[model samples]
Target: MYNQAMVIGKFYPPHAGHAHLVTTAAAQSGKVAVLVLGSRFESITVEERVKWLAAEFDDVDGVEIIGMRNDCPEDYHSDEIWKAQTELMRLALKSHGVTSIDAVFSSEEYGDRLAAVFGAEHVLVDPSRSAYPISGTLCREDLGASWPHIIAPARQEMATRIVVVGSESTGTTTLTKALTEHYRPRFPGIADVPEYGRQFTYEKFDTLRSVVPDAGIQDMVWTAEDFSVIGARQNEMENAAADVCPLVIADTDSLATTLWERYYLGEGSYGSYHAADVLPRRDLYLLTDHEGVAFEDDGWREGEHRRAEMTEWFKEALTAEGHSWILVTGDHDRRLKTAIETIDLIVAQRSGFTSPPWASRSSVARPALEGAAA
Candidate 1:
């Protein structure tokens, strides 16, 4: 039995396989030290990867997570390269007050060389990867295919949230559902977060009123505190959904709540809703235009006349925040097509993959939306 053992890896997003390797090492040693080497060019940041590791091993005793930002040598077989890399590893361990290592655990052939350098025993764990059957390369190539191997909560940053925001009866919910269905096959864990503000106003409050005649519920009379609660609840729901999926289709977000608070409760009254720090910025926003679309009176809609004005308010709010958004107009089919094409472009840009067929005819160029003013 080893007193101190160490494991090293890039842990690019740290999937279940990596977890198994670390946990196995911890079981054989009194204490297991993990070194997470990260590159500047990787999709996930070094800091974010470290947080995932800490969270994953929070309950496991004798597990220490350390992170380093360093790229691997260009020539792996060069003697000088190996010597320099080995020295760096020694320094990293020493910095953590771990001067002596009894064993080095790994799943790669390099485990032998690394252990030799420390004059420690080399312990290989699942070298063939038949046990966990996953790799960072597989995850980078296609996250959806490797979803089963990922830890759900650690995927929050991996999620691309596309929020549908607009005035009342502008088909935000319809478009949200359409987008969720369209991307379901490509992203199995895709989710749809329904509008929480509407649920609060139409459902929750109605229930309260039924229980008490004068439930202190005045129609269209909401305080800043009320809007704050709505904003907080909306954000909470979005986060919960994001934790489970790689892509979240939100019918509305706190940005919409900010607009509603300003429009109904007055401009400065929405001060409580300006706490954008707590809100998650969406990757894309599909602002449904009100032109040529007949307003269907949802029980909560203020009036048809306010639809255009409310749409403008949403645009101004989004523009003020420098959010990436595209104005989606026309009939249901056209609107859905535009949204899908835009989302495809976003996914392609993020993953460095080929765009879908609809992306070829995408309306707004990528630069224009990305460079929009705050």
Candidate 2:
């Protein structure tokens, strides 16, 4: 008989201790299955809470938290339906290469019954930090008082993940969107930066012109640099929540701002404004070609050659800095297709697989799946 481990719990917000138990049980034998008793309903949706769990833990491996569909009436909890659910869990374990439950890991009352069903030994793990050793029902009633201490003890270390960056009107937004649509269904985790062009254009473009008059280069430069800083900071703070996230597709990286400062300043005024130290570092850089895509005529200086020149200059600067940048050109659809294909290489380099993001990046063993940025 194939050896297996069985674990069960409500895991309202499956904390670190529960995660540790799940991983340990799975490591003991062929497979480890976790049965979530009250997984379906709560104030917070089950799906929303699970994502929080994945971010809380760094990696998702060999852990399965099964949820049951609502086949019965919402007003009643049927014993017949629940017995069937438990039996289905047992069958699922057997079908998924689990023969015996090496241990039952829990800090709840149902721990014994969970082990007995599988004929597996029950192990009481140290629930040192769990909110309530008895159950979460009483504690959740007046959550305002006991909530913080229960689930979130204090601050936890965050994952310092990298974000991609580039310049505006330079295809940063399009590329990020393309990469997301390209790999969303295939990858376990993905991230992207918010697009500021449309936002800035829609909200502040007119107001700045009327008020500042001489807004000139300073105005546009301020807009670009300011947005760059905001975008990078926002990404770092949120993406830090997950561990081993697939990759973050940033709209505009820091170097783009450096390039902007270099472009606006005349006669080597690059050192006068600021240095490039503040820009957040990225694992990969994708430089976009300027093909006379968009133009700003009324407010700022406009020329086709100037746009192309800046694109060329930024690429050269990035190249000198020992960074990798892919030059993508053509219309939106054409450029998007090229970007999706090229990013496949970047993802491959990270995953250690030669196949594309569509064909690879996902694994049968990888459980605790989390969606990309919403």
Candidate 3:
């Protein structure tokens, strides 16, 4: 057993393999130090990688997490390059009050050279990767497929944000719930963001009615400031949901609220909301059409007369903002199928991994509009 052992990696969204290497080293040594090394060009930030690693080993004793910005050459075969990188790692360890290393643990052949540079024994774990059978390159290529191998939930590298938006009585809420249920079985980390605008409106119902008699329901006397607050809250809720899941289904986003503000309060009112800038960018938007759906007045609805018009407004607004959206026009079951298909495609594209067998089933096809903004 060694007194001090060290393991270093880019941890480009640390997965289970990285965890195994670190834990193995910790078990063999009195003190195990983990060094997260990355550059600005990497997909995920070094801070995020450190956070993920630290969170994973928080309860473990004698484990230290150290972060470093690496600026060395990418080619590891060069002897000069290896020596230079090892020197930098030595300096970093010394700065952290770690003077000497008894062992250097790694999953790569470079461990031998690195350890030799430090005059330490090389402890290689799973050099063939047969046990973990995963890599950072594989994870980056297809996040959905590599999701199960990811040790930390917070490090969902390619989390897909899907927003369900449409006019009132268009089954946005119902579809959102169904979609969440559908994906949860395959991706257990799936989550959904509730309609924050409706929540805010309902929570402040009595107060608004007291101020204005016609304030009950969606007829409340709201201003641009009120919409701004709602948009901000909605964004906050969406981000909270995204943190825990690889796929987040939002009932509605700030962009939908901006459309509502423009529809009721006119175009000038929406400029103040800044929905595009404030709201988190969604991977896909499912626009529910109000053509066949009967507009049921839930007291908050703007009546059945303007349902089609409002639906068109949503499409126009989404298009103007250069959002990737698909128009779903069908019954409840058909709408659900379309949503599932669209989301599966997005998951595949973003993660470079194919959808599961069940999610691969074909559904009603629709042409997706892409990049329409000015």
Candidate 4:
């Protein structure tokens, strides 16, 4: 076993192959430093890749993950470029008090030269790619097909999150369910997160009924704390769903729960509002319009007359919060079609990955770098 080892890669999305390389290094070394390199040309940020890998290997001992931006042009033939790249790698390793590496672990051919620079031996693993037939290039080319290969933390960031929210009886649940069904063929693990507020409401009322058998829905009191609980649970459920699927549909999100807090606990209430500020990023929101849709008088629902007003509140809050949203109208079928078209466009746009300069820098032009920023 080596005293100190190093692994270096762009990690782009950190697929299973990268994990294997890191784990292999960790197994053979007392200390393994994984350098996550990033370039401006790439879409995924260096910080995000570092965080994902850190989480992925949190349980593993002797693995240290570090992120650094390296915009140096890829020219293995040039001694000058090699010197500059090795200096950056050394600085990153030294930050973790690794003065020298005994071994350099990598799947690339340049591992020998990198190890020589650090006065370390080269240890190549899976040079033929037989162990895990995946790469950053393959993941960038077809993210959906490579979903299973990506680490869970990275998957959460890459997933296309669609949230359906609106006032009561406006078909938010129906639209979320339909959207999940629409994307299930391509994203088999995709699922719609049910409204936690509704479930909470059911339980709250049941608890009240246990004490007073004749208690009705109107007697149920909604406090700021209740909305906060709803908002937190919504975020947890959404995150759990996104971890397993590349696409996740939700009936409502924490952001929507804030407006409901105002609706039930008066306009000044901001308990749920602050709680939702730290929730995960959502890609698209579909607001179900209350027009032409008659409100159903469910025994638990008392918002038929206030549907339009609450719908307007959702629109205003969504815009105020700087979230991307679209209004869905007409019959259920038409709404589904409109949602599908919009989501398909978003998914297509997000899935297109720009390879780092190291991969295909010849075709792409990069601005001259003044100095090393990492």
RMSD of candidates 1 onward, in order? 8.8, 15.2, 10.5, 6.9
Candidate 1 lDDT, tens digit per residue, 194-258? Answer: 98887778765777678776765344457788778888888888888777666788998887888
**Which of the two, 1 or 4, has more lDDT?**
4
Displacement of residue 354 (Cα, Å) in model 1 is: 14
Q: Between prediction 2 and prediction 4, which has the larger lDDT?
A: 4
Name the TM-score of candidate 4: 0.86
lDDT, candidate 2, 273-373, per-residue tens: 23245443345566666664675344434444577677777778778887766676777787677766766665454433121122111121111111111
Each prediction's whole-model lDDT (CA): 0.77, 0.49, 0.77, 0.85
Best by TM-score: 4
Q: How far is candidate 3 from the true structure (C-alpha RMSD, Å)?
A: 10.5
**Model 1 whole-model lDDT (C-alpha atoms):** 0.77
Ranking by TM-score: 4, 1, 3, 2
Model 1, poorest ten-residue lDDT window? Answer: 355-364
Candidate 4 lDDT tens digits, 230-280? 999999999889877778899999988988888888878887876588878
What's the distance in Å from true for residue 155, model 2?
16
- Return the TM-score for candidate 1, rounded to 2 decimals: 0.81
